[model samples]
Target: MSTYKLRQGRTMKSPLVNLAVRRLAIALVTLLIVAFAIFFATQMLPGDVAEILLGQAATPEAVAGLRQAMHLDQPAFLRFIYWLGNLFTGDLGTSYVNNMPIAELIGGRLMNSLKLAGVTALISVPIALTLGITAAIMRGTFYDRLVSILTISVISVPEFMVATMAVIVFAVYLGWLPALSMANEVTSITGLLKAFAMPVITLSFVISAQMIRMTRAAVIETLDTPYIEMALLKGASRSRMVIRHALPNALGPIVNAVALSLSYLLGGVIIVETIFNYPGIAKLMLDAVATRDLPLIQACAMIFCLAYLLLITIADLVAIVSNPRLR
Candidate 1:
């Protein structure tokens, strides 16, 4: 028995490790592609960093000086290689807008985005899971129908619209929540939560909505499987039959959806972040684009891409590991 168990463990371990390595390799290659695209595309844009700096007032001499300073005169291929090399050496350079290092500018705002994402994940995941379970267990009943209708509505609504409506309702009409503010002034988590209420709700709505439908489907599907029917026939309580039997199998879909939910939550939440004027990477990227801040834009883009990839990868691995069928 011990030897058999060991062999089984080895089999699982080997496949899992190989899968992780393959995913990691794919992700690394993907990162390179993304980086190259960002570098070349930004370089190929009509306006140079100097134009961004001097605005419409730039002259031949000023543009030349600025271009020289920014090394924009370099050949495109050299510029690409230089950009990639600098990235490897931890050099993101200074923002043309503020003259501050891109990293420093991003550092402050990144924290805010992280906090918002964290709060969102903490709130939405459980709510979504719970609602999903309820819908699944109550399949064919009014409860299931009601949740399905609501989730579809929520999912269909764009996050920006939700953000706008939430602000109007909560901030304008109710006067219960603040609109468009998460400045450096939030000194405590309590204050942060209060300020973040509407944004959080808006961010979580679609995500939780997606979760609801997926969860319902996953659970319902699992319940219909023959093994679950057998468990039910054994006189398992409703809760036990669902939780112990159906939920494990159902969780695969739920996990996959949750992972995608988080992936979309990355740069995809830019709309919500923009509506709220939340100074996360989304807003940061927006600002960079408006000002044509090359370094800042590239840095922000890379950060967002890497974050999205990492979140999706982690979610995929978690989903795979948590599901017996996949394992």
Candidate 2:
């Protein structure tokens, strides 16, 4: 029985499993570093949180008392350690400005951001993958050139510019959609469509451009392999050869591309949310910054960093698992 148990443990120790474990460990370490950086960065920002909260007319004694009550008087390193420990227990600390639990304040805003991101991803992913695959299959044709030129043009434009253009075209010129996305006003399908229209359009365009480019590259790379060439020479149809022979082999890179492209939403959504007056975490973070709300700012920054790390880590694991050589 002991021998069987030992053999079972050995069998479980595959390279892919080892790689995933290592990747997760790395992500945890990266999160910790990011947390430290965020805490300290917020600390370095101008003006004291207590001062900001108390306002200009407050007495020095009141400011000092407020500082001590909020533990602002604590040593920076000690405060960071305390904050990090609380984070382990899911205590995000109270907002210095709002005097509310950071978690409570962020909950709804975070959900809003997630909903926006989910909608954008749902619309963008299928379109990107289909266009990318089709472009790769039709390489050197007019369709391929058209996709290449369009993607390059879109990619060259920043998200803010895209969002601005979307607002101008849809909201100002056409008057087809609202420039602002009011999350709470959506009660019916029409309301939902109106609320999501401009932001989704902007995010979709930016994210789809990147995904298309990367997906096309990955598929094209896979199609150039000797086995793919041999499969084509065996009288396989272009579509069949690509769908059956290339895509499966290229799954690792394609998944990585999708993940990396989606991760752009993290950065891009900040601009999208801000421009459209969307009630999301990014906008909340901006508000927190203006008020010098250290806890809220740190929480929002950590969330973004954590999400970005999680996506990259997942992509790495998928790449490792999907590689035939690794298997």
* Best model number under lDDT: 2
Worst 10 residues of 1 by lDDT: 317-326
| Residue lDDT tens for model 1, 154-259 | 9889887888899889899998878976656789987777778877899899788987787778778888889988988899999999778887776657787787
Which residue pairs in model 1 clash with each other? none
Model 2, 2-38: lDDT tens per residue?
9998987676558789899999999999899999899
CA RMSD of all predictions: 2.3, 2.5
TM-scores of the candidates are 0.91, 0.95
Best by TM-score: 2
Off by over 4 Å in 1: 1-8, 187-190, 325-327
Model 2 regions lying over 4 Å from their true place: 1-13
Query: What root-mean-square deviation over C-alphas does model 1 reach?
Result: 2.3
How well does candidate 2 match the true structure, expressed as C-alpha RMSD? Answer: 2.5
